[model samples]
Target: MGVRYLFQIGDQIVYPMHGAGIIESIEDKEIQGKVHQYYVLQLPNKMQVMLPVGKIKNFSIRKVVDTLTLENVLHLFHNGETDRTLNFKERYKSNMEKMKTGKIQEGAEVLRDLMRMNKEKTLNSSEKSMLGNARKFLSSELGLINGITEDQAIDLLNYRIGK
Candidate 1:
């Protein structure tokens, strides 16, 4: 296997469970008698996430969306034409995986799907948590990419979904 480095220092990236995290530094550290280079990431809001250089690929860390694709995400959310399911656990799990891939558009799709589902009924606690996670992921990345506030990004998402 080969080591894969997807981001450089000073680049903004999104973590699966965490929101926006900036690559703070790249340094070589001795861990268990082996020297390893790692990408130090600081989550402005999370404040405590650190990732190794080689782990980026394994962890599925990735860059944000370009303008056109992000616009498509907005369209997907607004149109409400994607697939939906009534099973909360199944949907949540699928969304979690999408978020873990570090793809902004995929995360947006998950959010849109979940939000549509939520509109149909009262969400349970677990489903609510999943919704929150999806919201957090979308808001952070969308805000940074669009140069908007997190609140504004969330509002845009809600507005597009007509919620």
Candidate 2:
């Protein structure tokens, strides 16, 4: 619990299992007779999460990718191949893990793969849900980094995938 704070108020960060968020505040809260520092993040979904400062690294909390990394992720959409051999359950689990990493590239891959699969055949309920979630994750980050609307980001991704 001696780790120094890595993020400051107003910094943009990604919380694994969630999408892009901004650090709103750093506060000390007393619980069980111990004082703990927490990072309050306001997510793109408008939901807020308070995370313990000591556990941020363990939870994979990280800053949003820079422009170069964003460009690389966009490039991935154009050339990434879908692994269609995996069964539904296997693919779902794998994709879920990737999404949980909260990396822009991984989210883009999941979105691209699911879109390709959807084109080949109708996706089941689970896949359909994952597709929506992946899209949200990708678009949220894209919108934040590129200063565009989420709808615009979704259009950009679809256009890239179609290319």
TM-score of each: 0.82, 0.90
- Model 2: residues >4 Å from true position, as ranges? 1-3
Per-residue lDDT of 34-143 in model 2, one digit per residue for the tens? 99999999877679899998888888778988989988877877787889789988999999999888878888888889988888889999899999988878777777
Question: Model 1 Cα displacement at 21 (Å)?
Answer: 2.5
Expressed as tens digits, the lDDT of each residue in 89-132 for candidate 1 is: 67667777887777777777777776767788777887788788
Model 1 Cα displacement at 109 (Å)?
2.0
Q: Which residue pairs clash within candidate 1?
A: none
Q: Of the candidates shown, which would achieve the greatest lDDT relative to the real structure?
A: 2
